[model samples]
Target chain A: MREIFKQEIEQLGLDLVSMAEHMSSAIDKATTALEKADLTLAEQVIDADESIDEIEQRIDEQAVSLLARQQPVATDLRVVVTALRLSATLERMGDLARHVADVARGRYPEVAAAQGRSYDILLDMARQASKVGTQVVELLRTNDLALAASIESDDEVLDRLHEQSFQVVLDEDEDLTRQQIVDVVLLGRYLERFGDHGVSVARRISFLVTGDLTNAVAMVAETSPRNSETS
Target chain B: MREIFKQEIEQLGLDLVSMAEHMSSAIDKATTALEKADLTLAEQVIDADESIDEIEQRIDEQAVSLLARQQPVATDLRVVVTALRLSATLERMGDLARHVADVARGRYPEVAAAQGRSYDILLDMARQASKVGTQVVELLRTNDLALAASIESDDEVLDRLHEQSFQVVLDEDEDLTRQQIVDVVLLGRYLERFGDHGVSVARRISFLVTGDLTNAVAMVAETSPRNSETS
Candidate 1:
């Protein structure tokens, strides 16, 4: 019974990794959809979010069953709880990707970037965000605290690009309409938030490694838009 | 032991209610700060978010301890898991309130609404959001699924107001700067998300009553921005 329980716990971690991989793919394709004005790709990302969400639900049920059946205590119990948190965070990251896709779909043939306005900065943001997604998968799979540092720096890149996106829109003297402005704002927010969730998962990974509750608590606080809101 | 565990579970529910009340007050104050351009009130809302975060952490710690100590199964286990999910949803709601306060603080001495453009819709959004907050408290306190109906309708109202905000910003040819446009967009989103979290809590309550996991799963998907993005 103990051996079976240990395997179930290990399986839970693998499922979280799979969920992260799905989110990484979603953001990659969603950003591509945004970059190229590809409605088909955007629709695909939108449809794929359901599968991501279903995986989250499945993980939740498995985690709950592990707790109920095994009655894991100490380190074992924390593993189950941590899985639950990771699943929720990954699910949210997938939703952020879908929001980006929603912007692409909403714009249809018109690129959300709008004739390459802020195009370079947005591309940079997307690259950094995609990097964070990849890092999240690697972090979950390896449980490496060092990789989390890289994710934090990636998030910083995203934050900088998020700020630059606003500057580009606000300072543009050429043909920037209110609708385009709204799109840029929403897109920057969606992408930046995607990075924030990456940072959050990194912090959760820290908690899992160190068993430091402060890491998780501070993580939740930092992910709040209050910290990221434009000053 | 059984009686003590029951009390602990009851206390978990109460803690969630308290957290909801804090979020309710924060949004109310944050919206008032936006309306009045009262920097003091905005700062207060920002600072109060810490206490809300602390409440969430304390609730989480207590919930985990209960799970470990009692190893609750069946209905008791569901109660604890539901409490964890509720605490998280409420924490996110508080952060949404903090984001609204952040906007108010970011534009100190100048109303984020700026010359009353889209001000009415924003005020309507705030009012509905605060109402949802109140309804969330009632729903949690009473375990009444009927109130969930009211929360869902309130979310619809927020959705409409969210749409109207963009229309107001887009149509207004008078004195709308890019910064103000960005503010309206972010503020609209924060307030709308606040309502979404409220509706999320409503669904969790339904899950607590019915034990139908689909309600909770469907609720999370519905709250994703895909369903709410401006068409």
Candidate 2:
């Protein structure tokens, strides 16, 4: 029975990695759609959100079932709990990406040309975030604390880029309408938050690996730059 | 042994409620400080964050210890797990409030007078959020799903107020600069998100009682208005 339960938990971990990969891809495609103002790609991402939601629900059910049946303890219990938490964060990230796509779809025609440069910066941030997401899953799969810590460090770069994009949008000409600037700033804020969620997942991974939550926050603070150079 | 474990778990629950109360009060004070431009109050909130963090860490340790020693199953397991999740969310909410206060202190003298009306709107929103927070603790104490669902409904008012405040800051020429307006908008966002965290806690309570998560999302969707609101 213990061997069977261990096998089930291992499979659940694989399922979680698969779901995270799907989310990572969705984020990348959504970012691309936003950059190019491609309505078709945006629609694809919006449509894909349901699948992400479904996967999240499935993961939650699986975790609950595992808890009920296997009665997992110690590190096994932590792994299942962490997977559940990570799934929620991943779902939220997908929702944020969907939000960005919706915003892009709404403002496409009006600011397409003006948003070209800004979109590039946003895409860079999204790519960095996607990479971090991948690393988070990898860390979970391999139980790699150092790799998770490194992924956490990557969040600082995303934060810097996010802040820089905010300054770029805000420092633009005063003559520009509020809506135009608001859109750009909102986009930057969304990406910054997406990065935060990625950091959150990495933190969860760290907790699972070491059974210590405080270390993740401490490491993140130490790695984050003192200068707030993004502005 | 079972009785002792149950007693310990109950104690952990009470501690969680206490921590949530402290967090809710800290956020309230922080919001008021932001509105009043009270540096001392803002500093107080910042100082209080350490206590919140400490409580959160304690709750986590207690929950993990309970899981390892008692090996709680079914509802008992759910309660302990929920407590862990709740503390994590509460800690983040406290951090968000502190961030708002930091922004408030950052604005300081320039926003002291002009920010009054905006602060009024924010204060009202914070009050609503506090009510929801209180309701969440009550629901947890009673394990009452009905009360949790009702608290979920109240989140709508907070959402609308947040939207109205954001629009006012953006559309009206309130003697404040663009950065000031952005600061005000971000402050509202934080309060609105505080309400979100409240709803989340309530949802977790509902889940603990009924073992269902679908209804919680439905409640949030029902409360949300037709138009998309920025956070």
Candidate 3:
């Protein structure tokens, strides 16, 4: 019975990693579409969201089923539950990507002609977010504590870029409406938040392996320049 | 052994519900401080957050210990894992409230004499968010599906209010700085998001009890109104 339950739990973990990968791909496509104002790609990301949503629902169901059937004790229980919570964050990350696509669709003509530098910055942030997502998947797949720790460390880089993007918007004297500037900053923020969620998943993986949340928290604290400075 | 695991898990649930209740109160106090620009109250909320964080960390550690030691299966596993996730959402909710407190502290002098109508709207939103949080706690305590379902329903109202708040900011020709308007709208958004997270906790509880993810997904789909309308 233990062996069977372990297999089932492992399968559920794989499903979650798959969902995370899809979310990362969706964000990548959405970011590219936003930068290029590719209405076609934007629409594709929007339409493809139903699949991501379905995967999320499947992962949730499977996690719950494991809970109902395996009745997994402490550590295994944490893994299943963390999978469920992580799925929600992954789904939201997909939704945020869809929102970015919608924004791109709305401002296609204008964004297509705008200076490429700003879009480039946004793209960089998206890439950073995708990297975090990938690291989360790898951590879950291998149960690699070291990789998870490193992913936690990389979150700070994403934060710095996010802040820099906002500074770019604030310092520019560009002929943009207030709404446009706000939208740009929010877009950066969404990507940054997506990375944060990815880091959260990595932390969960770390906790699952070590039964310790302190290490992940401490790593984040030490690596995060803002938190370090405050301390 | 089953009895011991069950007792510990039940205690964890009660602690989590208690924490969620305290979070609701914290948000209420923070929102009131924001509307009134009451710096002292804001300071209290900020300082009070340390306790919330400590509770959250304690709950997490306890859950992890329960998982590692008990190795509970099915329903037992679900209960413990659900407790951890609920604690996480509650912690983030408290953080959001503290963020509102920070904003209030920053803008107190400028917003002190602002019109009463704006405060009324914001306070109403905050109250609704608090109610949702309370309902989430009630659901956990009683395993009350009906109460959980109602909290799911309330999320729609919160979404509508979120939209209305944004519309008001956009439509008003008030002599407010863009930063001020954004701050107000973001506060409303944060409250709305808090309610949404409460609904999520309710969904997790429903799944834990029924092993059915359908109802939760259906509720989320219904509440997530089409953004195409804005376009």
Once superposed on the true structure, which residue ranges of model 1 sit more than 4 Å away at CA?
A: A115-117, A172-174, A225-227, B172-175
The segments of candidate 3 whose C-alpha lies over 4 angstroms from its true place after superposition are: A1-6, A67-82, A112-121, A141-149, A165-174, A209-212, A216-231, B1-6, B64-78, B112-123, B138-146, B205-213, B219-231
Model 2 clash pairs are none
Model 2: per-residue lDDT, tens digit, B88-180? Answer: 777777777676667656667544324556656777876786676667667767878778778777888888888777676666575545565
Candidate 1 lDDT, A91-134, residue by residue in tens: 98999888888888988888876745577777778777888888
Every candidate's TM-score, chain A alone: 0.94, 0.85, 0.85
Docking class of 3: acceptable
DockQ of every candidate: 0.67, 0.33, 0.25
Q: Give, for candidate 3 chain A, the lowest lDDT window spanning 10 residues.
A: A222-231
Clash count per candidate: 0, 0, 13
Error of 3 at A19 (Å): 1.3
Better lDDT candidate (2, 3): 2
Which of the two, 1 or 3, has more DockQ? 1
Is 1 or 2 the stronger prediction by DockQ? 1
Q: Candidate 1, clashing residue pairs?
A: none
Evaluate model 3: give its lDDT: 0.69
User: Any idea what lDDT model 1 has?
Assistant: 0.85
Give the residue spans of candidate 2 off by over 4 A: A112-120, A140-146, A170-175, A210-214, A217-231, B112-120, B142-146, B170-176, B211-227
Count: clashes, candidate 3: 13
